[model samples]
Target: MIEENSLHPETLAITSGRPRNTPDGSINSTISLSSTFHAGGVVGYGRYGNETWTDLESAIAALEGGPTLAFSSGMAAISAVFSILPVGAVVTASNQGYSGVMTLLHTLQASGKIEVRSVDVSNSDEVLAVLPGTALLWLESPTNPTLAIADLPRLISAAKDAGCGVAVDNTFATPLGQKPLVMGADIVVHSVTKYLAGHSDVILGSVTTKDPALFSRLEDARKIGGAIPGPFEAWLALRGIRTFPIRFEKAQANALEIASRLSRHPKVDQVFYSGLASDKFHERASSFMAGFGAVLSFTLHSGVAEAEKVCESSKIITHATSLGGVESLWERRRKWSGESQLVSETLIRLSLGCENVEDLWSDIEQALGNA
Candidate 1:
């Protein structure tokens, strides 16, 4: 049985989706570096498909509970979603959305195809206020940099009522923490480059949606967008996904501990992690999450210059711009170009990894002390 032979997601990282032993008895899934996979001649070419990438695609689609389409980067996934909008259409989105998303919207507007309106994603009424004219409602729960949370079901219902498609950026929560498609999302999108890829190596994106109609439209756009991910990138994402449950478990634990320590640290002005009781979303997080996620935001007591020092002084945490990796990272979100002013200039976002909590705590404590 699959249950007996398979490891739970944690153990599966070391087992599932592997190439079975050849008669010679090998255990690992060998990387098929070929640009072409022509087993039945039906796979014919690599551009439209490949055997290994197809296998990885099927696995992730199963995990997300919907039909899927993959892309080279998270932005490509998002662009594929944006491609379906007709000229003069309207789109409703979050105030806390990823910075690059704003850039895309600017491009769409300049092309004379759409109008973009952003609102506080948690405030369902505000999102609904402009939904009547919208072609899409973009929700980013536990949004980037700020970590703000959104109620998926309510937003989806509102969008549906208005005849608009709902796309939830599920990168932060990942499927293990939240299943947006099951909850009513028209489409569930990810920067698989982050949590799903887990290792910070693959730069990929995916969109999973239950509606066959929407899937078809997005699928056509994906093939032409020429945003397809490389075969190896898909393989890497597939490999990384096996460890999600464990990676998330350890990262969540480390995040909570680090949040608690920083909340009490004298050199810290405030922490923005939803897992903390002091955050507005703590109750919602408690009700919805298996646990709080690994990303946390904190501000240095002295302000922007001191915030930069926290990044410069940290010993154990890497001061970088990306998140959801096996190694911890720290960065000033406001300074990350294109991010909204809502991200406090003094705030430094931390992405907790599988590292020992004590070491993370020491590094953070010492870095704040430098301020």
Candidate 2:
């Protein structure tokens, strides 16, 4: 086996999960559709394991520098992490992030399984105050919709000192952007349905960690809970990962330019992208991550009605909810009732794709004009 640190991330993305290249062997991994293996292999049952899933997990683990577990969806992977927490665990989480995660925490709190304490993750002092009794310090640096960035290294260190396990939602900042494990986080989770799959063709999630015990517990949860991904989805995700590095690089470049232009637009009141020098989190994100990422949020001079019009007016940019697809997409985040009330009703999230920069800008300009 090659040492994890021996190769660059770009090389690892290309070579990590390939099949042997012998004379007759396949160059790529095959989808093993069988539900059962013969007598006594490590994978005795289909629900327990699959070769395709293993290939996908191996690729993701290499990128994140840890062992990994694949799940049916992003929510399933997050649920697995919560499943391992002790009953009545006290959890500190970001006040603004993916609505799905916030909703899950709310449900768990209502069920009395865990006590949820929400805080502005960007404020280090505020987050540290609640760390004393927190079982898990859940974070999302460059938080969803609002794009609020947290000081990850400081928060991770403080959480560890407070005897809390730190789990970072690394979806917005992919492994290409930053490796949270290297910064001392205990666990890193991803909505692989986003950037990892690249094409937006599959729905999958993954959890990665350096801790073998946590990996084992999550594995057991996957087996018992039956939140495992199918062979086809795993295969598709792995295929997408092969081209991830190149795709992400192009998209990120597009986003940086777009954020710069949007900041100067007449209709734009605010642009929440760390790539811009004027953004509140620019310096922090510059120090914490390799790239500013491909997704951005902005608000118009008008209110929610104008934001909705911008989304509806886009021609090249699809008006959709999910981010991180090769085809550009945008939406008014607060249109969904499940979205946090703290998010401004006029904010629009734009997910950059591998499209020509001028085309994207022209589309945005027209949309803004139409709105």
TM-score of each: 0.92, 0.98
Candidate 2 on 116-235: residue-level lDDT in tens? 999999999999999999999999877998989899989999899888999999998899898899999999999999999988889999999999899899999999999999999999
Model 2 bad stretches (over 4 Å) = 1-4
Backbone N/Cα/C clashes per model: 0, 0
Look at candidate 1 and tell me the lDDT of residue 63.
64
lDDT of 1 by residue, 223-324 (tens): 677788887888888888878778988998899888988899888888878889989888877776656788988887687888898899998899898999
Off-target runs (Cα >4 Å) in candidate 1 are 1-30, 36-40
Q: Local error of candidate 1 at 153, Å?
A: 1.8
Evaluated at residue 119, the lDDT of candidate 1 is: 90
What are the lDDT scores of the predictions, listed in order? 0.81, 0.93
Q: Lowest summed-lDDT stretch of 10 residues in model 2?
A: 2-11
